[model samples]
Target: MSKAIDHLMKVHRPKQKIQNNRLRSVIVSIYLTKFVPCGDPANANGGRWLLTFGSPDMKLDDLWQETLLGMIGDCFSHDSDPQPLSRFITGCVVSIRVRGHKMGLWLSEAQNPNIVREIGRRWKSMMNLPSTIRIQFETHNESGSAQQKPIYEE
Candidate 1:
């Protein structure tokens, strides 16, 4: 990807103009999911388990890769559940920001605290996060709204 970016930059750097806002960055998002709309019965409610980093951490890349693999690779399954816990996962996102970086695990249900919290706990363990870092689960209903708040944290 870096090589491709370098090639693109080499080709466009000479013609670079402020008017065109293209090919400015690397990867934007990695969304993993099966088809299911907002109205789908399979997803009655939805939320995201959010983990924020103060600055770009050395482990960010590995954590993101691990999280991506855990979700799509069925690493969340255990003895307690009949199905893989990842079944409830709708998608995952990692956002790069100036203030902090955020890793989100979007889920199919937010109304159920049991599984939601369980996922949060497992997520912390998966990332091997220190206790100092807290991961919060915020319902989609609350995201970017006045009511935006985390219902669960680990």
Candidate 2:
């Protein structure tokens, strides 16, 4: 994934008869001190909330914007908790796949299921995704070819 790439929202994909067939992934990495792959200390224990849109739509832009704004604008917080959930978030990504586009929100801790689940719940709301739409929470570590179960979902 590209680190700290700008204008990711503006990056257009090649026209396709079926929009879901798009191949290239658009990644937007948000970091605290440095890039993740470059050994950013902040992401040592990071994980991400992954949302896959089976069918891309006009709302995709709006959903992404809301997430980015929530992170940079410090608008995320759990009930009765003054700590901003964004503090744990490291970055996000939008990866295009043959069947759909995957949007991921990276967070700094994977061990805390409460925080992780809370973030997922907030993101589902932030994106206005209905109960029909389910998202996954997974660690940043690659599990190789083995399929790892989602740690949590919301």
Candidate 3:
């Protein structure tokens, strides 16, 4: 199963590191935190966050990984003239729980209105999100509060 997933994501399979399920979760959490962006200007504005809410039986964790891999592949399909915006992708995450599932895409800059909007548009296209859904971008400062509001909505 792990090998199949690795192939689908176009990533080298990681060797099992822990026997205990709880300990494995802790180790994975630590590994994931290493990708958090630094406070440099390129990343200071935070990044675009796009989430996909899927039904409980959608197995969205797998779906998110597959979608990300597919997007990455599409970005580089031009060989020598790949899209510039692809470079802005910083990280992505998927969360699946008893209630539902969500996937997030994190980019490097959210300050440029044009770039942000383009990224959002391309993302919706590449991910093939349903036409009924509207994408939005929320800056870090604008998202931390209890009554957080998005900076822009499409």
Candidate 4:
């Protein structure tokens, strides 16, 4: 009876470890998805827009650049009006959360124009904001009409 109990414990230990690892992986994946802005708006007004990339391993600025380029590409393909896209996206606030190996992003309306315009211009889309609004970036790079900057301030 003692020998049988020992064998069962040994078998269960490995299975438990595997289950724990799997759970950790799932948690990490969920975190990553949250960091990226991938979801439908609550009002069902516009199509899904995923702008933020939620991993600490990934740079938010670079992800913004890529997202802008991708959106521009999409616009080019669909030939949609750039003005409305600029207005809608500029008014959005994206929240990205990343901890250790996990990340997540959430998007909603933003009251600040600086935040909106900074993110909007990355897509080469223009925004009209009040003159009282102030915009700042830690790093700014411009190549032709393409501009890039970090979305979050350090």
Off by over 4 Å in 1: 1-27, 35-44
C-alpha lDDT values of all predictions: 0.69, 0.68, 0.54, 0.31
Best model number under TM-score: 2
Off by over 4 Å in 3: 1-35, 38-42, 52-54, 57-62, 74-83
Backbone clashes under 3 angstroms, per model:
0, 0, 0, 6
- Clash count (model 1, backbone only): 0
Q: Any residue pairs clashing in model 4, and if so which?
A: 31-103, 34-104, 34-105, 35-54, 35-104, 35-105
Model 4 ranges with Cα > 4 A deviation: 1-44, 51-54, 69-93, 98-154
lDDT of 3 by residue, 61-101 (tens): 44455455645454513335335666666666554433444
TM-score of each: 0.74, 0.75, 0.63, 0.22
Model 1, 37-148: lDDT tens per residue?
3445555578889887775544666787677667656677787786678888877766654456677888888987888888889988998998989999887766768868
Q: Which ten residues in a row have the lowest lDDT in candidate 3?
A: 24-33
lDDT of residue 142 for candidate 1? 65
- Which model, 1 or 4, shows the larger TM-score? 1
Which portions of model 2 show Cα errors greater than 4 Å?
A: 1-25, 37-39, 143-145
